[model samples]
Target: MNRFILLFALCFHPFALIAQQPVPVKPRILISTDIGGTDPDDNQSMAHLLMYNDKFNIEGLVSSPSYGSGTKGEILRMIDLYEQDLPKLKAHRNGFLSPAYLRSVTKQGRRGNAPYRGYSKATEGSDWIIKCAKKKSDQPLWVLGWGGLEDIAQALHDAPEIQSKLRVYWIGGPNKKWGANSYAYIAENFPGLWFIEVNSSYYGFFSNNNILDSVKTTDYYDKYIQGAGYLGKDFKSYYNGEVKMGDTPSLLYMMDGNPENPARESWGGSFEHLSRSPHVVFNSATRITDTVAFCTVVEFNLKGPEIVIPQDSVCFWMETPYKNAVQKWPGYYLGKGRYGLKYVPKQAEIVSYRFRSSIPNVDFGEGKLTVTNHWPGKVNNTDYKLGANWYSDKADPALYEGKIQGGKTLSKWRQSVLTDWAARWGWLKK
Candidate 1:
């Protein structure tokens, strides 16, 4: 009778674990990374992905770095390591995608951040993203953004139709610091896209409260990762083997639960649906009286007397007070008797700025921006506030050692997640 009951329960479900919602057998994913850039954390994340690649139907690996000299060659370097470890990885799981295919799909995106307009010309990486997203499939193409949103912006600019077909999960904090222009473009233009902007929640992955000593960043690599395989050795080489895989949270979000439902508790941390982001436009220079939420993406649309210029790229530029010196941001010329410039304030203070144009007669003169606190908790937060359909950490997140805002959501699950990865790491242990 007990055996019959056990069999009956097995009949009820094939896999012991089930997701929050019905998901694809293997979620289709494409990764856009700054693997070779200033942050070595991405390299650690890439290593982790190749080690557990069986769970995903990996599509494209594009190098879309806004800062530093990240290139497709860096991705190829990791694939080279994966090639060596492929045999071992396949021993544990069947249907592991070939390294050759990963190489084929890998491509280079825009070398730098987009101009103030947000998008520039198309690259191999951006074109590949459009191609993959447009493929006829029941599941949406999940685009994991480990760095800048430049290629994603360029891809969307080139093909707006793909917006409906793509699901974006961007590791926001530091990456957003560098790719503000591209991020602003997407938030303002693509309001209905399925996007999860993990601005601060991702901070939970490397941080936690009351976690096992074995799972801490300082001990985890030595305990589970260092001697595992080729990927482990490569992971240890970065950040002195301390786990700072900030990009991996996006990968975990897809693997741990029903990614379609962002509010559900998962290893990647739960997020809230953000319907509206602060997007304000001004015809003239703004003043301290014209206040907006901190981290707001402000646009200045100027209509000057008609003037001709040889090139649009270098037509106009704005000078703003940043830190101790003045930093210049380029402005774009929008047709139909208009020019435009976008700015995202990072702190709660009155910012002053001036605009100059190559046309000589066209000038915005000067302006002041009043950035106010509206985070509901902390202040001067990341500038990753996105538009409608975008999911992010709650304003008041569970605090983990003085940090909060979507952080503890994942930290609470750190022990469980690390335990699972520990088992996987054992698979590579001969």
Candidate 2:
């Protein structure tokens, strides 16, 4: 009876024994970037990716330039830097991919933005995306669009069957503007596809709002990255030695949480679902504006010989002129009675402004209020703010109004990312 029972249990519970063996969990990833393009932030992000390569199974690195241009040579140059630092990185952690392996996977995608219909003819990079998606794997292939989505669009167009195997996280804002046609094609046609359009959350990586003063300027570079290794050297050379890895958050999202479930909170920040197909909210603060639409706030401390009367109440006036109209923007007291004001330009053309004080005792500082001839792409029209829920429909709508859900705040999310980055660079203990 005992022998018969043992045989029955063995036959019926075969998976029980197999499940006892620990299975390694590494999410498969493919980075499609425009590294050698106009913005050098992509290059900075790539350096951070290579430094922490052991976290994910990186399959491909393709150049998909949107606004400016990109090439395989630029990708190779960074890989060469990685090769030099491979030994040092290996000393800290295992599983760093070899330089030759990364080189083999590097390929070129579309050079410019896609047309109105989204895709052009097939390119080497687009073909590679399809091939990689079809590979037999339990894991889904995560296609990170750090640049334009043209190649991914082309890949899906050429091979629609592989749609089920793909999970895309596109760094959208201005990149979306560049690939508007292609983005429309993908969202409109592939409704079942899992896509996360990150426009503003990625900005948290470099935004001055969340970062500590020490980490923002020169302290972070001097401590962990500047002279650390080959990767550090290359990182220091880019963007005049600023730690602006805008694309790193996409990969960071995959590193901590269950890659199969994007809704779960992770180091990369959380996201909500879209109400409709992902579209750019023009003239809205829902997404971070490009550099063109930035508001510059300058503060002046009334002191020294410039102060004519200490008892006189001073009120600064800020005048912003839009097309055919000029409005006086509100100025608030920034604690300790400091004068400051913020204004987002409405038009794309040059906006002129004038600053004066009601009290004659107050001075207008060094330069007169002069707005340069620059275009502000999309200005904020509504008070709709950007958050983790910007790209996700799974989250509650109330969170979009700047309410905290699951105890998550933008500042907390930013800290989580910085902490992870520090750990990867051996700045913090594992």
Q: Which residue ranges in model 2 land beyond 4 Å of their true spot?
A: 1-24, 211-214, 278-410, 423-430
* lDDT digits (tens) for residues 304-382 of candidate 1: 7665543245568778877788776667766645787766665457888889876767888888877664432232233
Tens digit per residue, CA lDDT, model 2, 1-430 = 5998768656753322222111148778899999999888888889888888887788999999966867888999999888876776777788889899999999999998765456778999999999899999988898988998899999999999998898888877557655655776676567667777665555555655433223453356776665566667677777777777778778777766565555665556567665453222222111122234212112223332233333322256556554588655433333343443334332123444565566565444322233222211234332223332225422343332132221231234554455456666663222
TM-score of each: 0.79, 0.65
Residue 111: error of model 1 in Å?
Answer: 1.1
List residue ranges in candidate 1 displaced over 4 A. 1-24, 208-214, 280-295, 300-341, 345-388, 397-401
How many angstroms is residue 188 displaced in model 1 relative to the true structure, after the best TM-score fit?
2.6
Q: Clash pairs of candidate 1?
A: none
Cα lDDT, all candidates: 0.79, 0.62
Number of colliding residue pairs in model 1: 0
